[model samples]
Target: MMFGQTPVTHVGVDPFNPPNPDVWPATMAPVQQILREGLDLGPVTVFVGENGSGKSTLVEGIAMAYGVNSEGGSTGAMHHSRTTESDLHSGLKLTRNPGSSKYGYFLRAETMHGFFTYLADNPSMGRPDSDYHGMSHGESFLELILNRFRGGGLWILDEPESALSFSGCLSLLSVLTQLVDGGDSQVILSTHSPMLASLPGADIYEVGPWGLRPNVWEDLELVRNWRSFMDAPQRFLKYI
Candidate 1:
């Protein structure tokens, strides 16, 4: 089959064997939404929410179901540490494009240290791995993107802003833009950064207690909160 321009096009669960609501991830609003109504994806998909709002979990599930390593690595990578991943991927139904590249990478912020260690232990082909450990957090992240994230495939990231400075986030956006411009790459990013949510051509979703819903950058709670804080930090700080 000829490779298509998109990777996974939608994510849902089989109603006949849907995840139990009593379970942890299924109890989350976003997960529940996915179970009921699968998410339709685009070239760039951004998820924004507060902490513990299930955005990260939803992203992780999609990446894992798409066959990327749960601990943050490329497809078929064997970089495992203590598992905090939910079982949401176990029964996920991914609607992949008929002929998209199956290759993909997961870059979870909290697990990147271990992923770096994994990369060092298993360098690609004849080349030795770059010293990702030697670099500072932001430096390593940018280096990883520059070094590994070329070509058309899926790129799933969970809260990458955790390791990035404001400038670093912009750099990340540049790389993603280049990937999408190639017309065969799809990006799924769950982030607290308003900058990332503003990626051109991205379909933004706001994950919250009400479940995930299509949203615009200006109306996102995360964006509004950041704007409010930046406009007058004193208004919020006075409560402390």
Candidate 2:
């Protein structure tokens, strides 16, 4: 079942006048090449890969193309410490279902500190329960999702597992389940956590040197490696 009333139907690099390959970031090359054929999206689309695989780059581009802040937060939460954004968004295109997005947010683990700082500076934007700085990273993340994320919106998260424990991951899973199942919301996440990637009915796409490809949760390299490590920590530890 599709989650959002306005789930993204298609996304790809704009064909007419694409960025020059030489000027594009190396990380984005895979997606840029793959997007030639156009990529279809579902209610929940996930991008997964090892570090530097361009998962974040792809998701960030999508978020920017959708008009959300490149660092993190909603479109209105604009603040930039230093611009490191790639030009991929300019070359990307998104097609959503008929209805307009009610709301949107982009959360990147690495930039939440800066985002919170921005919010702190702009006290008017503060939430009633705004004490994110005092809470643990995982707690703050959960709080953001639970409070800021109203249903019937678009949420793009990058490496949320960075701050989450296993239990926190499960909590996020539950929250996401509620968001997708109970409301009209669409989520696109970039993560390495097998637990998060295993969201029931989510479409997992593996971004790598070869490009984007649909992958089964269990068959993913990250999942297999994590499972192997859990099965025998001592065996893998010998290598270290």
Candidate 3:
């Protein structure tokens, strides 16, 4: 019931560390500071930010600090983006609660489903009743939430719901709620999906050109704008 103990605190990062010429984008903005500074939570957290914000970088750093595979569970090898290591420095430090056990898992939007499939099928990985390959992408996504994700672990997911249809997203939300209610698992996710961001009690950290900060779902202009248009689609359609 107590879940392990240790909670993540400090983490190593070069926040906006100057990018090396070999990587291009000569000088991307660095994070400069830990976004989660002084912030503590019961179990779940979400990282919500725009493209190119350093969310991925920070997550990767945290993954390394906690000994989670950037690729995913059981598979430590990862084909990370060159941008991630362009100007990589190891000096970044990661601090966590002494009682908490650290575990990290990242699911990039592009290969979220595929990654899950690979893990679900791997013999060494924990076996699941559902066949990952046979399921539709959305179903497989749900399977990850229902079968693979066990509470009490630190999971880093990047755009995990891209593969899920709206219904699938709802299914994931349900599973996430169960995890948090159990007070055993902690999640750090990067996603554009409003449904995923809407999780109750979730700490939404929006990473952007400015930096990471606590945010509400409404603060995401895209969501509000889309909803506004949907309320009266005909009005916006006239322009097109």
Best by TM-score: 1
- On the 0 to 100 scale, the lDDT of residue 212 in model 2 is 84
| Best candidate (score: lDDT) | 1
TM of each candidate vs. truth: 0.96, 0.92, 0.74
Q: Taking the tens digit of each residue's C-alpha lDDT, what string does model 1 give over 160-225? A: 999999999999999998898888899999998999999998899988999988988989888899
Misplaced by over 4 Å in model 1 are 1-4
lDDT of 1: 0.89
Superposed by TM-score, candidate 1 places the C-alpha of residue 31 at a distance from the truth, in angstroms, of 0.7
lDDT of 2: 0.82
C-alpha lDDT of residue 62 in model 2:
87
TM-score of model 1 vs. true structure: 0.96
On residues 143-218, what C-alpha lDDT tens digit does candidate 2 reach at each position? 8788777767788999999989999999998888777775477889999999999887889988888888888998
Looking at model 2, residue 173 earns an lDDT score of 87
lDDT of each: 0.89, 0.82, 0.60
State the displacement of the C-alpha of residue 45, model 3, in Å, after optimal TM-score superposition.
2.5
Worst 10 residues of 1 by lDDT: 1-10
Q: In model 1, what is the error at residue 138, expressed in angstroms?
A: 0.4
